[model samples]
Target: MYPERFSNLPEYAFPRLRALLDHHDPGGEVVDMTIGEPKHPFPDWVPTVIADHSEEFGRYPPNDGTPALRGAIRDWVARRFGTTLEADSQIAAVNGTREALYNVGMALFPERKAGQVPLVLIPNPFYQVYMLAALSVAAEPMFVPATRATGYLPDYASLPPEVLNRVTAAYVCSPSNPQGAVASAAYWEELFTLAERHDFRILSDECYSEIYRDTPPPGALEIAARMGADPERVVLFESLSKRSNVPGLRSGFVAAGPRSMARIRQLRAYTGAPIPLPLQRVSERLWAEEDHVIANRALYAEKFAMADDLLGAVPGYASPEGGFFLWLPVPDGESAALRLWQEAGVRVLPGAYLSQTVAGENPGKEYIRVAMVAPKDKTARGLTSLRDCLYR
Candidate 1:
């Protein structure tokens, strides 16, 4: 018998999209704008670095992370966020932040909070893993809406006092996945303050932090440091996938307080898949270099501009402040997506698929998420077709 924990889970996003669209023939040359895989070139030197360390792969890699790799991550955090973190005590590496994002809940959430079943807070239309993580721990998974009215960030403070008291942790995505709304310094402050009052940890997913419009989004770690908040109060997950265009490498780091780090590392020793040493070596070098990341950001900036030029006049079209997805409004997400596929040959994800329906209302019911990971010209073509097909 299957475990009941995941029985209520909806079909995953891509498979659901495939079932919806694959049966129909494309009216034009098909353009896939559904997934967020980066199409831009990663640095050419990456293979050479991996080759140089290839022999090391024969040895079982450290379950946490190599000292050099962790040091590089520590230095990058210092440079990017201006917060000091000890590589040995405060950081643990994983095979992408997705793994850490899921496993952290298993490692940290207590059986009870305030003598009640713990609650794990999540933003609606969020990365699906957050809710699953909450469920793995048997915590009551609470969905807080991050709609236009709320600046596309969840407002945990709005929850009742009893609910807040039972919260063990919250998952927040800055420069959020589908909408691309970034959390400001003030937003982080407010959320951290709420966490302080509620006595819950904050999981800050900042994978898209490197891909923004004009300014680098302020991070929770830096904000917490500035406020002199407890270091254990905030845990950050960052990746080389979005930043360095190396999703296949599956290398990222998680930083937390000493006690939490120990727990995370201990958990890793038992069941975690550590990144291969050769790949870890490559990630270390990538984190040290800034030129490649700058160039990558510029490419996305051009695409963002193209999306605006094509869809700007469309009603309810809002440009994403960061990340590469456009959460475009439509009359109905599924209907619009089907029409886009059959008529314009553009594949997009229905927003409702990423969100949970609560009280008979799905926050993403009226939207489709379009990825801008294609090349500039291809992305432009898809955007224009989408605009013509859906809006006009």
Candidate 2:
């Protein structure tokens, strides 16, 4: 029997998009700008390193990750974020950040809270996993709007007392998917304070932490350390998919306060799928090196500049602070997506697909998410076609 918790769940995004636009034929050559898959070149040495470690694949991989991989992650965290963590005690590797993100809900959410159903606070127009994770635990999933009026960041501090009382966890994405909004230091401070006050865990999704135009985005663990907040209140999930252009590598890690790490590790010990041994070796190398990441960031910066040059002058065009998406404003995201596909052959996701309807309104209805992960020339052409076919 299907779980009652998922009964009201909205249709998954891609199928909904297919239903919305499948009848129409493209007016021009198709250009897909919907998904946030990275298109940059991966490091040349990665394959060789993975192949070198191929002999280890016959053995079951360690749930806590190999010491070498863990040390590399620890060193990378220290170098990148200036936060020190013991490789053995405070971090655990997962197949990818998505698995870590989803499983955290299973590991932490309580059966009941304050004599009521527990709440899992998630940003509207958030990663779909956040909501599903909450539902999987039978927690009430609260969608907080992250609209332009709120600087594209949810104002969790303003939530009603009842909601706050029941909240057991909150999922926040920095360099947020679809919006590309990076959380500032002040934002982190506020969230940290709120988590402390409300007694809820903060799961920070920072997979897009490396791709930025101007400055590096501040990480949740870094900010938590700087604030001297309760260490266990925050957990961070990071990935090599976006950072190293190795999505198929399926390498990511979760770092948390020791107590949280213990719980997550305990749960993962039985159910978690560890990244394969060879890929872990590749991830170790990828995290320790910065040259390839810097080059990839520069490529994205160029794309951001190209997008600005093409679409910046348009009304309601707000450039993203970090990451590789452009959340372009339109009259209606579904209609604009269909129009772009039918007229310009540019495939983009309707903002509505990424958001839930609340109070009879879908916050993402008037926008569309454009991924800038294609090659420079192709991305430029796609953006120009989108601009002329939709904006003009």
Considering every candidate listed, which one attains the maximal lDDT? 1
lDDT of 2 by residue, 1-392 (tens): 99988888889899998888888998888888988899999999988998899998998888879999999999999998999998998999899888998999989889899999999999999999999899998889999999998889888999988789899999999999889899999999999988988899999999999998888999998999999988799899999999999988889999998988999999999899988888888888898999999999999999998898999898989899888899999999999999999998899999999999999999999999999999999999899999999877
CA error at residue 371 for candidate 1, angstroms: 0.6
Error of 1 at 182 (Å): 0.7
Candidate 1 lDDT by residue in tens digits, 1-392: 86697798999988999999999998688999998899999999999999999999899988888899899999999999999999999998899899999999989999988889999999998999999898888888999999999988899889999899999999999989989999999999999999999899999999999999999999999999999999999999999999999888999999999999989988988989988999989988998999999999999999998888888898888999999999999999999999999999999999999999999999999999999998998998898899889998
Candidate 1 lDDT for residue 152: 88
Q: Cα miss at 375, model 1 (Å)?
A: 0.7
Estimate the TM-score for candidate 1: 0.99
